[model samples]
Target: MTAPEPAEPPAAEPGVTAAEPAAAGPDSAARPGAEPAEPTDADAASHSAALPGADLDGADLDGADLDGADLDGAEPAGALPTERAAAGVPGKRGRRRVAPAPEPAPVLDDAELRGALEAILLVVDEPVSELTLAQVLEQPAERIGPALDRIAAGYTAAGHGFELRRAAGGWRLYTRPEYATYVERFVLDGQSVRLTQAALETLAVIAYKQPVTRSRISAIRGVNCDGVIRTLVSRGLVEECGTEADSGAFLYRTTTLFLEKLGLNSVADLPPLAPFLPDDVEELADATR
Candidate 1:
């Protein structure tokens, strides 16, 4: 039996330093006097590896390199504006600056504005919201708000008998405190030290919404009614019922005298206030301070 010997290596071409593989394709095969082939992605990556400490972090490892040729000249997806700038990529601008919100235009001339606000205030029993007023006047809320303030300030500056003040989440006209005494005296003339309008209003709230706290009454009436509550208690029309379960605030309710004074047999006999109240009365009560 004879052993076979390994074949000898193939002879190199005259100009080539090494012999090429037998099955090499045209692009892959070595040639005589051929210019250096353009580098492919793998070749470029190998070339980049030889340059140690050179930053290629931002470079595309695939066919799409920093030049972004493979991207059809599009900016790299998800690149921020500043990043695109650093990469020397051109960027289209964003949408034009949104036009500055138009200023609240004048809803009415000064005279008409004052007249309109005053007319509304004079007739309103309860405080009215600026939003409500704005809707009525067909004006923006911003316009209505400032006009109300200016009207309030002007009235104060002129020392008017009545004043425009904000309470119960709204604006209202009230007799100036300095004149409240005179107003009470006139409104109470010849009466048996009777309830003033405020006392009456407070009593009515307790009658309608008994088992409520003093704060609740004030919230509904849009004024601090602590004194009025005390007056009603002293007059035997209201009494402390119990504490509110959650807040532990002292709750008040109408006394038997309340029914007698109103000529009602029971609370259910009291007149319904639906026609005079807003639909969102519960929300109103909650929102008001």
Candidate 2:
């Protein structure tokens, strides 16, 4: 009696069982208060497809504010703008725009071009070539020739004192030939200046044997002509042309002014030296020249 069986272990509560875990099932992990499961690949892909620009691979939209974009099947906000696409920047699929070629320089009209040519010709000292004038005026060479022709015609029609002529292989301004008498008289001023005997001889030698060197002239005259040549040069009768190829000495020649004073068009107009020299000397002088 005193060691009667210990009271039977208290019975579990009516709704409770032995302390054991419940059987796990698919729904067990998805209880009402439980955290949701991570999405599967299929579900993630479908969701992404529903978002704008999701199909555009490598598109970056981190800084974009897409609030204004249409959410119902509209183009992606991540696409390049149409303007940028058309400018040949990669992507967005548009015709590339090309800048128009630079417009050609406007051609000047005849009157305007001729006026410019006249202005340039007035200030130039040496003859100006057609190519040079074309470069300066920014006109075509063909146009320059026609413009020069018109300018020359206008000057002629106006009877201007100066005329444009092609000389020394280029265009230059020259006093009309008809005005030469008046020009000569004005230059000489009714004074008869004469060259000394030595200067005259030197000038004659230089005229016939043009482009001759001082040493050659000395050899021919049997005396030094350096002084006489200097005198002639100072009088504007002769000028240094270039060096003799064989002697490397300075070569002298008569000048345009010299022809002007002699009333000749060119050196070829000089009279023959036959009458002024002995028969033998004449042949020798002609042969020397």
Candidate 3:
């Protein structure tokens, strides 16, 4: 009924017996006296015990390849003994590696702290808030606030007119009240430090319209400020440091002295000027006059 019962499966050739699995001899089979060919905790201990001149302490071979040889269940190339371990020193067992002692907590030297505080005051036109300073330096505000106080006292003791002071949400350098008049007179008379109307206007625009381009300034002022800008450039009152990505336009900004002239420590210290309007254009003209 079945289709001729597929021809009787071919019989084996004479003496060509199916290969029998090689019989595992005593030596090939796992035995109590033989080191377990596979790694086991006990075999690992035994192989490690047999290691010559191998130190276990400080020596680490976890995950080492043994190629199916357990060396008495000791991992192949198991952590060898170290001299320290051999000498009974303690070992770090089962402990994962840790990073080195976090770079000694970065203690700032006195000069570094002092210089940083001074630089902060020099760049800031308004008092730099402790939080802001901390953010800039990537330090804790609490630490920076105290450091600022120390810097202030140092400046005062040295009779420096400008000292660190906090107000309006930041720390700033300001002249001592006692030196205000004298400082004013000096600035007014100093040939190198004279302020001009054009400089003032440019400074105002930069302060108010920061990160602005020359074209924007020209548009707002309704006159070409190229000459005024040049003058300011000559006086070191403004600088062109970079071009805007949009249109590759040149941008301008006020310099530190702009803050100095107004006795201000930061642009934040600048008084909010009244917004100029078409109707106020007349007033601006008269004021310029």
Candidates' lDDT values, in order? 0.76, 0.76, 0.69
lDDT of 1 by residue, 136-236 (tens): 87777787888888998999999889878776456777787788679888997857676899988888888787889988888777789998888888988
The RMSD of every model to the true structure, in order and in angstroms, is 17.5, 13.8, 15.0
lDDT of 3 by residue, 1-289 (tens): 6676557877768755443233576666444444323355765687878989776856557886645442442322345556434544333442224437755346567688678778767876555578877677666667887788888888889998677766545667787989877988888775555567766777678778887888888877777888888888888768886999978988898776565545565677777665544767778778866
* TM-scores of all candidate predictions against the true structure: 0.34, 0.46, 0.43
Worst 10 residues of 2 by lDDT: 87-96
Question: Which lDDT value does model 1 have at 1?
Answer: 88
Most accurate candidate by TM-score: 2
Of 2 and 3, which scores higher on TM-score? 2
Candidate 3 Cα outliers beyond 4 Å, as residue runs: 1-139, 146-162, 166-173, 181-192, 219-223, 234-236, 241-248, 255-268, 275-289
Model 2, 17-124: lDDT tens digits are: 343223466555444543344566766687889898757456577997765454443344565667455544533232335669999767888778877888888888
Worst 10 residues of 1 by lDDT: 90-99
